[model samples]
Target: MTFWALIILTALVTAVFLGFSLLRGRDTREPAAAYDLRVYREQLAGVDKDLARGVIGEADAERVRTEISRRILAADAQMQAQTAQAGPPVWVTITGIALVGAFLVGGAAWMYNLMGAAGLPDQPLSLRLEQAEILRAERPNQAEAEAAATPAPLPELDESYASLLNQLRETVAARPDDLQGHILLAQHEANAGNFPAAYKAQQRVIELSGDQVPADAYSHLAEMMILSARGYVSPEAEEALRQALQRDPRHGPALYYLGQMMVQVGRPDIGYRIWTDALRNAPAGAPWADAILAQLDELAFRAGVFNAPEIPAPAISGPSQDDIDAAAALPPEERQEMIRGMVNQLSDRLATEGGAPEDWARLIAALGVLGEGQRAIDIKNEAMEVFAGNAEALEIIDAAAYQAGIAQ
Candidate 1:
């Protein structure tokens, strides 16, 4: 009400001022014909003076005087005509002022209605935050989200693969305590888009692992639950993520899902920070890297980060299969020497400028293959320190360490 009152009041004041201006009588500017007449009369006087001074010949002076006289007569007639004319009627001025006032107020309201939320109440920052919190707290849970989700079409399976999958499921069902059977069931179920079944099998796997469960177990559980809910991160999924992060603080899947949950809860600022950090430390072809890159721009915009830093592409490192094949063709001693030289070059580069997790893993594996167990252990420890806050990198390093038979 106050907003409308102010707008109407301003328009009325403007209109009233313009009305007074219009009613203030005729214009005071001198008519053009009147000024012209005065100038012609002055010219006639100048011609007479010139004739008396004998500055011009009598014939020329006479011609100038006659011309000036003719102009003076024409100007006098025009001045009289202008004086006889009347200003517009009072009603016409009043109608014009009314039209201008209507346009000012009406046009403004119309334009605003088109461009703005016309009747919506003002939503200040604090109020909006409160509303968001309420929404987050009241949002649907896992089962409810899943029930509301549209079911995706399952992929068609080959006959032999389907038969094997059925046999595996039956075997897992018959032997609930079989850890490997449950793991295979979970993997196959997830591949078949049967997230509910996959997560159930994963839950059994986690149970079978007892206290020795790894972070990836919980991360996989959360991933399945989220997929079951059609990408909605429910409270159940969040709890699973929490467990994953508790086991490994920098777990990639958990962090990715947590960022997604933050966005769903109207906290894109936190989401943006989490995703950017995750992407920065992520290795090439990490599952979540592509997903993060796809939505990063919109997330940054929502987080009010207009000039967000450019996202770095995931680094590809390590020797290619071609390098291995080329080295394989050499004699034993030559091959060993060539491998040593390559390892030294990689080590020097890594020492001068750090490389990706893949590079560190490759170095560790190469040292292990070269029977340099102690060197592999040292490189693994250094890689751990370098990627202390990155769980995915640590996992890669750990796998390489295990292959090198140096895992602690």
Candidate 2:
């Protein structure tokens, strides 16, 4: 009620001001003939003054007087003509001003009705920001809940696999101190979709390895727990992931799983950042790279960060002669690490962000040069999917793969 009253008051004020301006303007317009007559009388007075001062001869004074008289006659004739044609009726002038006032008020109201939320309360900036934060907090959990509601189809394993699993379990139990036996049991159980068993086996492996256990062991243990829980990041799993990260901050599986936990906990932005960095540092054929790429777009959307362009892979001109010469200045081991880092960067960029044909070709060639023929082949296949409709890109990538001896 108060809001509507304020709008009404404002409109009434505007209309009143406009009406007063229109009426004042109407009263201010004098007849053109009256104005001309006043101007002619002033000229006649000026001519008389000149004559009295003797500044002009009598002839010149007479000429000026004649012109002024003619102008006065013209003004009198015009005024008489104007009087003959009746002026606008007072009613008509009042009606026109009223119409203009109505238009000013009605048009404003009409436009507001069309474009504004007339009955809605104003949304101040602070309230709007708070609402947006709430939405962000809820969106990730909503996505996770939807995913969890749909149960995955059961795996079809052969009886031979079950027999193999039993044999592995027995072997690991018989040789409890054999770390390799525990590792094999964990891997086979995980592969066979027996995640609980895999988790126990991985735990045993961690125990046997003691402090010498690598970060990846904890990461794998965490993963089996998540898989057993159907993707739930239980507190124990979170602890294991945290421990893995503590041992190796860049452990790919740990980073990827931690990102999933972050997303499930309603922190998609943090999840995206962690996954993206992990993808950037991941090796060419790493599973973490694939996992991150698969979810990158969806995570970005959930975080309200859509429209991030797929950065084209860096153009693939290899090292120049100067670059080769510069590398020679470094020690051999450092040079090898530098080359490996550059290759990993290129591979990660293409895998996560995609790139042009030249970039894919360059990456394939570089992998081959580093004696990673299998990775080059896998990248070529993936690039083929990315460039499915572009014959030119397919040809370039194919030719590069052939040159690298991985085309088949």
- Give the winner by lDDT: 1
Candidate 2 RMSD to the real structure:
12.8
Model 2 per-residue lDDT tens digits across residues 174-248: 888877677767776776777877899999989988789778789989998888778877667888999999999
The 0-to-1 C-alpha lDDT of every candidate, in the order given, reads 0.80, 0.74
Model 1 agreement with the true structure over 262-381: per-residue lDDT tens digits? 999988988999888877677565657777878888999999986444445544355533244334433466456645766787888889888888788878877866778999999998
Error of 1 at 63 (Å): 35
> What total of clashing residue pairs does each candidate reach?
0, 0
- lDDT of candidate 2 at residue 391, scale 0 to 100: 96
- How good is model 1 by TM-score? 0.58
Instruction: Write down the worst ten-residue block by lDDT for model 2.
Output: 319-328
Q: Estimate the TM-score of every prediction.
A: 0.58, 0.45
Query: Which portions of model 2 show Cα errors greater than 4 Å?
Result: 1-153, 174-177, 304-408
